[model samples]
Target: MVTGGFVVDLNKPLVSQVGHLGEAYEEWVHRPIVTKESPRFFASDVLEFLTLTVWWAVPLIWLPVVCWFVSTAVQMGFPSRQVAVTMVCGIFVWTLLEYSLHRFLFHIKTKTYWGNTMHYLLHGCHHKHPMDGLRLVFPPAATLILLMAFWSLVKLLTPPSVARAFVGGGLLGYIMYDCTHYYLHHGKPTKGISSNLKRSHMNHHFRIQDKGFGITSSFWDKVFGTLPPTNPAEKSR
Candidate 1:
C-alpha cells in the first residue's frame, strides 16, 4: 500500500515506525518502475523512447567529432605520435573513471529523501528495471553534460594541442563503454570477451552488486579487489 508517495509494508505497520518513511524497501529493489506513468518526473513517452534508443546514434555522432579533434590537434603543432599516445592514455584513464563512478557514485547508499531520489534517478532505476530496453542506455542530455565537463577540465589543465587529443580519446573511450554496456544487456554473444562481459554484468546485476563494477573491462575490478568470484556453474556453461 502507498501513502504520501511511500510504499508501506503492511505487516510492519506504519504506526510502529513513526518517524521513518513508510516506503517499502522491497519495492525499490524488485519492482519495475514504469517511467511513462510516473507523475513525479512528468516523463513524455517520446522522450523516454528517444533516450532508450539514442545509443545507436552515439558512435556515429561522436566518431567524427573525435576524428576532427585529433586532426586539429596534429595541426596545432603536437607530434602525431605524441597525440596518439596521449589519446591512448586518455582511454586508459576512462576505464578507471567508469569503475569509480559505478562503484562510488551510482551505487552510493543514502538515507535522506533527496539522496535516495537522486540515487534512484541515476542508477537504482536500472537495477530495478534491468530489462527495460529503453532505459539501458545513457540519454544524450546527461552524456552531453559529462562530455562538456570532461572536455573543459582537460582544456583547463593542458595545452590546447594535448587537451584536444586527450578529450577526443576520452570521448572515444566513453562511447565504447556505453555501447559495450548496452550490448552486454541486450546482445547475444555466445563466446569470448563479449560473453564474459555479459556474464559478469549479469552477476553484478542479479547476484552481487558490490563486485564487478567495470562494464567495459574487468582490469580495474581486479585491481580494486572487487572482481566477482567465478562460479563453477558459470565456468561449465
Candidate 2:
C-alpha cells in the first residue's frame, strides 16, 4: 500500500499507522505517507539519499575503525588483560549512554521554531514515520561526528591504552544496538528475547511513549522505573 510519499507493504505487520499525538507535533505523523520519494535539502541527491538509508553498512564501516583503535592501543604497550577489562567496561557503560540519549535527548520537547525543527529532524521524524526503512538507522555522517566526539572524550578522560580499548567496546555496543533496533522494527521473531524486545519497542511507539526507553537492554528502564507494564491485562487496557 502506498500513502503520502512512503511505500507501505500491506503484507508487513505495521504496529501503527496513526500519527503521533502531541502539541506542536501534529503535522508529521498525520501527514499522508507519500508514495513518491521526498526531495532532499542537499543539492547532491546521492549524498542526501545515502544519509537517509543506513543498515549493515554502518557497522561494517565502523569495524575497521574500532579495530585500529584497539590494535593501536595494544601496540602502545598496554597489558592485554587491562585492555580487555577496559573494553568490557566500555560496553557496560554504553547501556547507560544509550538509555540516557533515547530518553532525554531524543524525547526532549522544544517550543522554539529551530528547537522543534532540530528535534523533529533528530528523532521526531522516526515517530512520525516509524516504518520508513531508510530513516530507521542512524546516518553514517551523524555517527562519524558522534564517534569523533566520543573518541576525544575517551582520550581526554583516560590513558591512551584504556581509551583505545574503551572506544572499541563502545563501538561494538553501538553496532549491536543499531542492529537490534533495526531487527525489532523489521524482523520476524515468533519467540524468545528477540520477540520480547520487538513487543517492548512496539509498545513504546504505539502505547506507552514515556516508558520502555531501553533498547539494547531493559535493565536501565527497570532500574530507572521506566519499564512499561508487561502483564496481558495491563497491555489490553
Candidate 3:
C-alpha cells in the first residue's frame, strides 16, 4: 500500500518486495526521504494524528509523571539520598535500555508480513524518512502503554519506593533522549558534545544504520563495538 508517496506492503515481507537476496532491500531501506511532514499511517485522521508527535510534547506530557514518581517516593519516607541514588541508577539503566532496543528490537530483521509491518511502523519509517519532524519522537499514546509495562516490570523486581524513584529517573532519561534526537535532526550544534552527538546520530541515519545506536550517548556504542568509523577517510569510503 502507498501512503503519502511511500510504498509499504502490509501483506508481504519487505525483503520479498524489494529483492529476494536482500542487497536491494538494504539500499532501499537505508536511503533517506527528507520531508517536513510525516506520512499518513492510518486512514482515520485521529489515528494518524496520534502517530505524529511534536518533540516538545514528550517532555510536556511526561515531565509531570517523573516529578510525581520522585515526589511519591519521598512521601513514602524514602531518604533523599536513596531516592537520588535510585533515580540516577534509573537514568543510567535507560541509556543501556535505549541502546539495546535500538540495536535489537528496532533493527530486527523480520520475515513475515506482520513482522515487517510492525517494524516499519515502529522504526523503519523513521529511518526511511529520517527528517520527518513529526515522527522523530515516540507518540504519547504508544509511550504510555510502554510506560505501564516498564512500571510493572520494575515494580515486580523492586520495592515500591525504589521502583518509583528509578522509574522517575528513567523517564527523565527518556525525555533527554527524545529532545536530543529532535535537536540532532533539526537543531544546529556547532561545538562540543551536542555537535559530536549530532554528527554520530546523523551518521547512523545516513551512513551506517547498524552502528551508533546510542542516541543520548555514544558510550554504549563504543562499549558494544558498534561505533561507526570516525576517520574522515573511512567515513568517506
Candidate 4:
C-alpha cells in the first residue's frame, strides 16, 4: 500500500502519480471510501517529481559545489587526506548541525527581538508553510553566505590547508543535510538505507518536533541528551 511521501500534499502542482498502485483507485472507482475528504493533494495525471519537486532542487544541485571548488582553489590549499576526512565527517557532521539548528535556532521561544525574529525566519516559516518546495531548502545565495562565514571561522582556528579541509567537510555536511531534508519531505521513501533514513527523519514531523532533532543520525541527540525515549514495542517485529 502507498505509505508516505508528501503526506497531505499541499500547494503541490499537478503531479503524475498512480494513486496507490491499484488498490486505492479500485476503491475510489468502486467503493468510494469517503471518510471525510482530506485536504491531501494527491490524484493527478501530471508528474510530481518533474513538475513540483525537481524545479525546487535546481539551485541546490549545481550551486554549492561550484562555489566549494572555486573557494577551495582561491584559499590556496591542496586537498589531502584531511579533505577526505572532512568529506566523511562532513556527512556525519550534518546530524550535529541539524540537531543544533533545530534545538537552538529553530526552537527558540525567546521574547527578545533578535531571538524571536531569528526563530521565525529560520524555521517558523517552514513550519507554517511546509509545502513551499522552493523555500524548503536553503537557497543558493544564502548557502554561499553561510559557507563564507563558516570558512572564515575555520580559517581563524587552523592553518590554511587544514582549514580548507575542515571548512570543506562542514560545507559538505550542509549540502547533504539540505538535500536529504528536501528529499525526505518530497520523494517517496524507498526500501533500503535511504528508506530507513527517510523514515527516521520524517518521524520528527509526526511524533515530536522537540525531540529527535537529528536528520542523518541520532548521534547529536545522544551527545546532547535529547534523544527520543526508547520504543522497543515498535521494534519488537
| RMSD vs true structure, all candidates | 6.1, 6.3, 4.4, 11.5
Clashing pairs in 3: none
Q: Once superposed on the true structure, which residue ranges of model 1 sit more than 4 Å away at CA?
A: 1-5, 8-27, 30-51, 232-237
Task: Estimate the overall C-alpha local distance difference test score of candidate 1.
Answer: 0.74
lDDT of each: 0.74, 0.74, 0.82, 0.54
Write down the TM-score for model 4. 0.62
TM-scores for all candidates?
0.80, 0.81, 0.87, 0.62
Best by lDDT: 3
- For candidate 4, give the lDDT: 0.54
Per-residue lDDT of candidate 3, residues 47-148 (tens digit)? 677778889999999999999999999999999999999999999999999999999999988645566567777887788779899989999988888789
By the TM-score metric, which is better: model 2 or model 4?
Answer: 2
Q: For model 2, how does the per-residue alpha-carbon lDDT over 62-133 read when each residue is reduced to its tens digit?
A: 888888878988999988888888888888888899999999999887655466556766776677567666
Q: What lDDT is reached at residue 15 by model 2?
A: 22
Residue 114, candidate 3: C-alpha displacement in angstroms: 1.5
Superposed Cα deviation of residue 150, candidate 1 (Å): 1.1
What C-alpha lDDT does candidate 2 achieve relative to the native structure?
Answer: 0.74
What stretches of model 4 exceed 4 Å from their correct place? 1-79, 111-117, 229-237
Candidate 1 residue pairs in clash (backbone atoms < 3 Å): none
